[model samples]
Target: MAFQWQVDPEDLFVERYPQMVGTGLPAADVDEVRAAITDMWPDRSGGWVHEWSRLAGRYAAAGSPWRAALAYGWAKFPALADTPKRTALSRQVDQYLLAAPDFDVAFDRIIVDAPYGGGHVAVPVHVLTPPGWSAADPVLLASGGVDSWKMDLHGWFTELALRTGMRVLAFDIPGTGETSMPLSADRGFDVVRALIDHARTLGGGRVAHLGISMGGYFSARSGLAGEVDAAIVLGGPVERSFDPDRTWAYGMRGIVGNALGFDTEPTDTELAQRMSAFTLRQWLDQDRNAPMLVLNGADDVHIPQADTLVFKGRPETEVLLIPGTGHCAVSKFPEALRIMIDWLVASARW
Candidate 1:
């Protein structure tokens, strides 16, 4: 059984439209899509995938591969459970490749093996090196959450490389995007550690991590374990989010369940048990961590403000709660990005 969304499709589309536009989709194109999508599921004629893919086809025909990629990206939005969504993901990757050659920075897509389940899982990574970057320069590992994958982050990655002068390596975290492994709380950090190690080899033995939303969990883990020189977590849940007593807000259960590798939605108890392994509370109690910056919107409803506040007293850690914005400070993203890049440069000495 596929996880069914509890929220209405139209409402979901309206809520996520701004984010799509923020990720580089032209506002007019997205609005056109909004007029076409009457259903959220792929099975319907005017469904989310169908309408978005239709728009993508137009962009591809017009030689606007980046726009086409963004359209296809929305076609597979939220999760990749059904066949149509999976196909959209494939098209999204193809269009992303088509646009890569025209990118401002040098880009390379590399496949590396990361240990998982006592074996190696092939992980696809997008590396962006700045114009003057060298092998001995600093490297930053960047990633997005379950819904927003690596290709969706190209704008941010390119900006980071250009503004900070650090080579940027972007990848989807486990169970999301192109990662071959399913989401396992116990084994997910293996992917992060592998990327950190690979980053070390690419630069002057100094590596940093910047993770958005759920990807921020990995950043916290890497920092807590002293794996990276610095780590930044933006709107990432750290603790209390996995508490069995707490309920998932904003119809997030279905989307998160899909990323957790669940074909059928689990009961609250079952989900809690699985999520228990993801908490970093134990490590937080310990006295060691890399230099870290933790941030989130003060009004973020998806993750409790306490998750960001928990890092306040920790050594070498800075916390910022952007006022009047929502998750990941999406509304004030440019400000957040500036703060993040500045902190990374000074903390990592890039």
Candidate 2:
């Protein structure tokens, strides 16, 4: 499938920090790197890719293969043609492995079974345990949205685990990254349950879920199903996103459709139908709900602000609706991360 630009590629690149800032690059370098990517679809003038590729080559030549791999991964961001995407991804892996010995924490990449289509699918996860962490340590599943793949969240996930002292298993939501399974709203939680099952095997202890953007939806679902001990849903949409009356602006619909694995952008009606399958309001009956924390930006354009309020009456649920913040609340990442870490620490004791 030829990749379609969700929005003006320039605007998307300029607005990259809310998503890519913590991808193990210096702040100025992140800005410079994003500014250098001036590509658009229909002809994807690959100036951006070229720059990243050039950086990768330079890093490799300097004997810093991990830095090179990280650069190549940046080049593959969002999406690309299969041939180039695969090549970039392979280079990223090669570089990451080459550079692993230099890192403070070692990472284990593993695949777990998850339900997909009628059988099961493999869900790839990058696991990092704290020093002296035993199998008995609680596991926290960290994930990102449709556009934010797992690799991009590695640094953030690592810090989260280190701070909270929880074992971290970071992965992408179904529609993105290595999950690659067909996306179905109703079946998405099956994957979370499956991951929880796998987490129990690691230590047979508590497992919490923290997800950003689209991944938050899965975290919310897992919380509601009591599949996890705790969940932090950041900028997740529940009813408002799927409401047929509320039209999404800024290519939000297209972003969601891509996550749903649409061959083409689905019509408004079809999008609503598919999204409605993910409604957490229908499952809020005080049944198997675990402690939940719903956080979001008040000015979020992609997700309806009211969606965060859906957890209001639920027991052990907390909502932190920040005013003047944007989606994912990336600008306030430190504050948000602190809140989540505090909550995770508290939840683990319960």
Candidate 3:
């Protein structure tokens, strides 16, 4: 099955400051600001630049205000509004994911070690198989949750490996797992890369990578880093790059991460600010990693399913559109695991 990168672009969404965005539209105020910016800089990208000129003359009209608000979302959080570190934002976020009972996790352990010297750290990795592991299988990980575990692990990872041979190695990111590595731009891909290397030493076989939901970030990251033999991305987000101003939402997290600097990794509000400038799209597997499978959910609120499903180059890649699932709805469709097993078999990457 070849990956198809075609779905409605509208389904793609990167939730930014739900509290702020949830606030009534900042359109009215933003229009005034955009007009001022356009009049002064004249040279800019986007349709708003041209529209501003027309709106400038009709500033008195009711519709003019709407036009000016074109860049309100971007302006409200201009990448440097910097979330205050009033308290430990990292700890708060940690409690939300790791400690949150609603997450419903069943994993091997809280911390893990590498085969060689790569610096030890705690990674929340879920192994599909049990007790003693085998070398004939593969390890995989995805960005989203529930579905990845229920859909991929239970469905494909175990059966395929037990029958033909393969295993799944799924993990949450640093900030996501025990290692509270803030999702900084400079350090996003490094997490998957590390996992790939460690998996090779531990499992030692043709690695099959799985990128479900938000895991699309890790999928492309590990792929480009040239570690996995094959990749599977479900609802991959292929935007130009990180939203540059994504840090404004991390209110007071700097004080949280830095205060416990010794207890946690060194991450300041400035780093998060810098991260806003980059997006996950900046990194793509291209041909460096081949034999990829993309499963898309039509209503995935996080990563839209339409962007990276085409067969540009690869060992091979394919996309399957599941209509009922949201970002984490793979479990709803029983065919998901079967689709993946068939893909690996057809690609001969298993």
Candidate 3, which segments miss by more than 4 Å at Cα?
1-110, 113-120, 130-133, 141-165, 240-282, 285-287, 310-315, 328-331
* lDDT for position 316 in model 1: 90
Query: What digit string (tens of lDDT, one per residue) describes model 2 on residues 1-350?
Result: 32354566566654565555556655666666666666633324346566677778888999988668777876766553345665677787778778766655667889898877689888888888777677777888889887676676667787887887788888878777677765567777778678888887776588889989988988888888888888889998766776777777655566667667777767778877777777777666555588899998777878888889878877888898887778888767778888888888884434
Write candidate 3's Cα lDDT for 1-350 as tens digits: 00111212111112322212222225554345343442211224322333333332243244333222222222212111122211122222322233223222223433445222244455656555433446654555444421122221222344544443455565654433234444433454566666777677556656767765446656755555556787777555545323433331212233223312223333445444544543544455345556667776666554444445542444555656777765434434346667766776664553
lDDT of the structure predicted as candidate 2 = 0.75
Report how far off residue 239 is in candidate 2 (Å). 1.8
Best by TM-score: 1
lDDT for position 61 in model 2: 97
Q: For model 1, how many clashes?
A: 0
Per-residue accuracy of model 1 over 1-350 as CA lDDT, tens digit each: 24656556676665576688898888887888788777777556788889989999999999999989988988888788788988999999999999999999998999878899888899999999889998877899999997888898788878989998999999998988888467777698987899899989988989989999999999998888888988999999889888888776555787788888887878888788888889998888999799999999998878899999999988899999999898899888899999998997784432
Please identify which of the two predictions, 2 or 3, would achieve the higher lDDT against the true structure.
Answer: 2
Q: Which ten residues in a row have the lowest lDDT in candidate 3?
A: 1-10
By lDDT, the better pick of 1 and 2 is 1
lDDT by candidate, in order shown: 0.86, 0.75, 0.43
User: Considering summed lDDT, which 10 consecutive residues are worst modelled in model 2?
Assistant: 39-48
lDDT for model 1, please. Answer: 0.86
